[model samples]
Target: MERKQHGTGEVVFNAINYTVFILYTLICVFPFYYLFINTISSNELTGLGLITFYPKGIHLSNYIQVLKLKGLPRAALVSLARTVIGTAATVFASAFLGYLFTKKEMWGRKFWYRFVVITMYFNAGILPWFITMMNLGLTNNFLAYILPYIVQPFYIILIKTYVESIPQSLQESAQLDGAGYFTIFFRIVFPLITPILATVAVFSAVNQWNSFTDTLFLMTDSKYYTLQFVLYRYLNEATALASIIKSSQGPVNMNLQNMQTPTSVRMTVSMIVVTPILLVYPYFQRYFVKGIMIGAVKG
Candidate 1:
């Protein structure tokens, strides 16, 4: 193979591209880095705005103390349950509905797809939505998190577009082998559509994991609260939380080293809330662009 030679203009363009991307990456990463360093640094120094760019007086006590906070574990469990259940339900519903809509034999296919897609443009206002959920008995219910998100219009559209891009003959061949729609979907179409499904799953999981608004509106019970909601509350009531910690530990034993300042508490909670999504993002990143591009452009 012949090595391609770069012209001066091409060299300059490459330099600019690398510089721009590197700067952009750092800009995106700095906030998370800042939060992490602040959480691990001395509370006094953090409060004084002294720790930046790197951690100082490093200790794990902030995480330890935050974990010891009341209801944190339960809230984490609730958040995990909803993320798993909601993401699964959303993926399955999107795949099934997306496939179903592509079938010409299905009754009212166009109309139903249109009806579902139209939801992306508009919804009943919050008060009406709340009333509907209340009527449905979703208040303080775990199903509130899972049910409403199952049929997300945008996800359906993405899956539908990707499914349409699959060769029609694959489904035809499965049908010819006496496979029904469900069997065809499972045996053939499903495996082939993994990329798009992964993309949708990432999206659904993040949305489910980060959601706190539903908890605010529908949950009066702390038992049903999610980690995100707990974090939201922690951010709002950082001073109260610090006071609670201080009182629980006894003021006499508490020193500057063991203290839980509002700033430290806020940063620690934010870091805790953000870590999972950051960990999970890289896994799905490979499929994300390819799936979304095909889904968007082909549709």
Candidate 2:
């Protein structure tokens, strides 16, 4: 009887665990699943909220409509450039800064490090921050997206801790070989900390990819709008514009039966904005896991 009771309890426990895991996965995955189905489905079906657990009335018009939106191609190019360039620059800068802070010889290191960390907690308010950035010639410049985030304190701290774990003997040997700080950093330290650098690159790439506040405050021209910013404007105006377009049914060219709806266009844009980051994440997943594990080790 006890054996049977134990077996029953074990079965119940396994069932509960599996149930929770499936629900968790569905919770995480359902939004993207819904978005994809809606994007590929007919606009009328999407507008009717018919894309829940499964797709309905499939069509490619939503994707076609998205490509037709104004300034989108330019915005996409700008966002891609920003993500690549900005991520590269930020990783290098933060690693270098972090490496320097970890060194025994860096003068006033404690005070400087503390000051940088303080900026993480207490931001200069947006108005003042914007003014400062503009005064630094960031306004209307794509550099606005790249420069300010070059050496983020949070990333620097992570890298700094990771750098501290490197055997000091490596640096000592490099010093005996007449290596300068930059030489040791680039040749020796940089290669070994690939995990942390890859992790930081992921963070920087995501930030650059998703950023829109820079575009809102700094860029007045459509040429400089990032994908997220352009998409944001489209979202704000999409419903109203769609209503107008829907109402303007013509006898021949602009037929009501062939019209795309706002819902499908919005879902398509969301997929566009989200897909690149999603695709890139898997490539960095191993590095991210290793880096976090190593960084989590306490001094």
Candidate 3:
């Protein structure tokens, strides 16, 4: 009787926990949901604050207008290329360094680890960074975005923690079979830590995808502008009178065309910029969650 009562209590507790979790999830997701609904709503309805829960009128013209603006597709492609290549390189380098740090016999390991840690809290400020990039002739180039932040210390630490949790006996056994460090790392270690690598890849990719400041500061060439940079320029131009009357000869009336309601356009731009990450996330979500749980606890 007591055991049955205990089981009932545990079930009730779990039910309450699940209810709270779902509520929190909804709270977190509501903003994005609202953004999507508002983007498709008519500007007049949105201006009157009528687009709270759902779109008032179904109009797809905002998306069309955003796309019709110059440089949107090319900027998206630039962002996509940067995210894919940068994330892959970051994962490989971080995993390799993580494996190296996991070894107990490596010389001056403490010193090297401390040096990496110091970088986490300190950085050469923006001016120096800009000067250094200029000196290296990286300005107005795609490599400027990719190479500057490829290896992040926090990612390295997470990977190292996951690597440490792998059984040391596996490495010893591989050595006994005449395997060197490269073989052990490539053939044995990497397979076991696939989950953690996937998690890191997701984070690195998201960071690179949403990045705006770096591209703005480093890339002056119109051809190399990332999606976020283009969106910012579009937003600024969309609200300016010059943009509306660029092809017109006479002074443009702001009240006549009603073009100031570019809030919907901004929302549409945001949706476009974020759509790829949202699509890719569900595929790796299981691995990402599992890796976080294991890596965090193991560390």
Best model per lDDT: 1
RMSD (Cα, Å) for all candidates, in order, is 1.5, 3.9, 3.8
* Model 3 lDDT tens row, 271-298: 8888889899888899977787775763
**Poorly placed runs, candidate 2 (over 4 Å):** 1-19, 240-258
lDDT of each: 0.92, 0.85, 0.81
When 1 and 2 are scored with TM-score, the better candidate is 1
Candidate 3 segments whose C-alpha is farther than 4 A from its true place: 1-8, 241-260, 295-299
Worst 10 residues of 1 by lDDT: 290-299
Candidates by lDDT, descending order: 1, 2, 3
lDDT of 2 by residue, 155-270 (tens): 99999989988899999999999999999999999998999999999988999999998899999988999999988987888886566545544445453334667776577888
Judged by lDDT against the true structure, how good is candidate 3?
0.81
Give the backbone clash total of model 3: 0
How well does each candidate superpose onto the true structure, as a TM-score? 0.96, 0.89, 0.88
Q: With candidate 1 superimposed using the best TM-score fit, by how many Å does residue 27's alpha carbon deviate from the native?
A: 0.6
Q: What is the lDDT of residue 47 in candidate 3?
A: 62
